[model samples]
Target: MAKNTTKNTEGQAPKGVRKPPATRKTAAQKKAEAEAKLKQQQLETGEGDNTPTDTPEQPNNEPTGETAEKEVTAGASESSAGQEGKTTETDKIKSDANPPVGNSTIEDLSDDEFDKGKRDGVSDDVEDQELMEGQMKLEDDGSTKIGDNPMLTDTKDKEEVQPFVRKTKIEKTSSNVSIKSLFKEWKKDQALRAKYRQEAEEAIKSGLPAPEFEDETTLRFDLAIQRNETWTDYQKSDLIHTVLYGYYLQPVLVEDSNDGKKWFIDGKQRLTTLMTFIEGQWALSKKTKPVYGYKIAGFKFNDLPSEMQDEIMDETITLVRIKNMTVAERDEMFVKQNSGTPLSKIELIRAMHSELSEQIDIELSSLKFFKEDLELTKKAKDKFIDVELILQIAMLIEEGKDRIKGLGADNYKEYVLRLKETEQIFSDEMIEKISNISNYLTLAFEDYEMDEVKKALKKVNVPIIFWTAITAMDDNLQPKLFGDFIRSFLISGYSVESAYGKSSQAGSSKKENVLIRLDEMSAALSQFIDMIRNASSIEEGVEQFNKHLADVNGVDREEGEDGERESA
Candidate 1:
């Protein structure tokens, strides 16, 4: 007999804070629940939640807040996936045993006490202005104050530091790049998103497909490495490892197609990681096995991200090499900004490199050629590039708005264009920004202090890689692109899938197979790395990633579930 579900109506909805208000926890999805919760909490409020181990949705979204909640959240008892009963100390997750997740905040965050004291995180000043521009009420001096609007309090009470601006007006260019185009071109996920996956359960009940062999592309990411202002050694290693093994190593369609419906071309990193993971490298010391089982049936350290490994097992690895896509695809994937945070990291780096080449000839300051490369880079590249790295630099240099390091209402981008002229801010060029950055990275790795809040450098092994990949690009005034990253990554997962159930498909080849999303975990990680390391705009990067995530799972978020504060 089925038991009845009851609801109390006096004033409360339920004893617990259930997002979707459903109860179906599996060995893996259950864990995803906790991960999902942590990711969301971190995003909704720019800090790790440190709720008691028993409550998944309550506090300290900090990466190292409490393993008790992550490991013991109602359904974690099924497997011992390194999910110990309790432990959320300042130390990394488990370096030698599992390459720790996050550490406490005690090390340098690259800013002195005076600087840190003056900032909480970046203010949404620009975002608020964009939202309330014509509608804003001003004082006699034409300045907006916190007392004017209550909503502005979120940006002000936080004590965020407003960044200095020095950019001229943004030259407007015309294009058909709609919001949808921003997130275009990835592997074609023709499958019936969550519905098809959910049907696996029914398929099994009908005695058709097996549990372990369902669509392996279903992915789930670790919340351990998600952070912004601060990071620890474990967090850094996890970031690099997650990228190397998960997304870069997974099997994906890399090539582009004529029709918008199809996805082609997979990333190179996806191929390399699979070789080491699934193939088992038996001849080498690692001695990898060539067998496949439940998500991560036979791989080593399978617990961490076995779900994605399973997806790789299901698909055939094919290389899609195209020097330059045909006219249209090239326009879409290579240079398109279909998504908010599209290819900012890569395109921006290339843009930065391109801009530095000319070095803004002081003698030619009167010539338009001086900043032509920088300007054109923005127009030519997709919005995706802008969202990631470029956006981060904006947050860091400006008001720390991108990273949430300063306070105020969001006027960042406008401020940059109006006052922070690009040349004047960075000596017309910011030199020596990278050399010693490597030294700090090495120090972080060798017995370093940590941030429990931001989980700074917790998983890094190659800090220089992050420094160059993320920084070393065009300078935009903003703050904490890192915080944006944390919030967006989680929002992507939440918006994509909230309730887990059987696929609605009637007769899928994957019928009877337990729908799992392990494969996409790597993709998520890859996109995250590619975004953080290469995107041109933080807003663009988040949008693109979220869209790609939706494509992978067939679950889209409402328009405002998560977005750049341009509209506030």
Candidate 2:
């Protein structure tokens, strides 16, 4: 029992078979695991990078696919959180009693990492070159020609004044910095950008050192403020109130100049507000609620307590300093930043692609109907509704109704692209034909100068009636009596109802609704035009036109019968 201690030498575990010391992890794998752990921690803490989740896909920059997935997933989640935060805050403050300070053009500057890429509100892929190209087409030479209107000044000269280059190669100014420290230092510099803000504020308080207009930013401000018509006093007050409440003031975008001053690319209005208020030129707005227990609305900056003034001074904001980009690039960026504003789709298109927009604008302006007749509301003007109407008609004539109808409101990206495609399809010959059609419409609506015709035209905002009729006409088949055609189709009660029905469909840009509306109008109007062209007399033409319209209306009512109730 005492003697089992001695084992045979062969019984010992074989050499090199001691289970290899648990296979120590390689340094590279350990490093990878550590990095992954750090990334997970960052994600959980919400301190990860905030670059746009929708940046164009490119070759993976990370060494491994797993890491790339982690970055993308984290970035997307972060963006969603920021978006939710903005929505919640916006809903809480958006009350009927408080007049809107400004359009949603303002961004909340608190989110330091938020990047408003092209087409901020529309969609993520808006910045794609192909997508942007679909917004509009520039002239072959990348310059626009003014239409043949003596009243319209040559815009080529204005184009010449723009910077030859649109963007600078970008470089980072800093990783991240608080607005309190950055502005405090930035203000002390005596360069043009800094000097102007300082002098403008001092001048407001002391009535000395009049502001100078040297740079584009200051020049634009001078043009707006000196004219005194661009923004009303109430608008100015409202903007001030919004900024004070920390709701939605977009960060000022700037680029550094050689003289150590930054050039303002956007946010002119917000900057002007801050400068004006600091100098005591404006008081707190009457409607603004005080922040941090400081209810000082209507109190001049000088009248506020020292601590309150300090609190305002120390308030931090995000300032984006982009180093290299062209002027055109900057303008587009400005458009994207302001996309949250209540701008119309066409307006956004104009900003996204200017050369083509200007070309379209000039051509539309040249039409006598637009120049001397069409009466657009101020809201319509802001939304570029007139431009959209003209573009829609022109595109429809060029590409047929199906293509136009397919471009729905929700498919804004596609709609813009199709409109841009019009430039390609509308050759010189096509343009001339369209122009001729416009001229014919002008003559048909000859009494457009009269208040009654003007009223009727305004009431029928859709231009499709003219488009449908004009497209359906034979090459040389002029109506036997153009005046009769106009009176019956445009100024008449039935014509008004048909056109206005399409206009009400503006609530949605859905493909189905758009197609239905356009299809109905085109069918009825084309038949009317053919009847007018073939009839021996105006009375006969009117009879046929009325009968066709009645039949078409009856058909439309019965067509969507799936939803109709059956009589008991």
**Each prediction's Cα lDDT score?**
0.34, 0.50
Q: 1-568, model 1: which lDDT tens digit per residue?
A: 8775777676556657554556755444534454465455445543334335565553434444345334333323333367655443212232211221122121222233212221223222334433232243334464644423555546655766889995533222222222112112112222434556667778888999845533333121111111111223333333334443434323233332333232322232333333333334312122222223323223343443555534434433333323334423333343333244343333323233223212322222222211221232433323322223233333334342123322111322333333323533333223234223323333323332222212322111112123332332223212244334333433333332322112212221121211221122223445765765566876677677766655554554565354311111
Runs with alpha carbons beyond 4 Å of true place in candidate 1: 1-265, 268-270, 281-296, 299-319, 325-428, 433-568
RMSD of each predicted structure: 43.2, 33.0
Lowest summed lDDT over 10 consecutive residues: which window, candidate 1?
220-229
Q: Give the TM-score of candidate 1.
A: 0.19
- Work out how many backbone clashes candidate 2 has: 11
lDDT of 2 at 311: 57
**Model 2 reaches what TM-score against the true structure?**
0.42
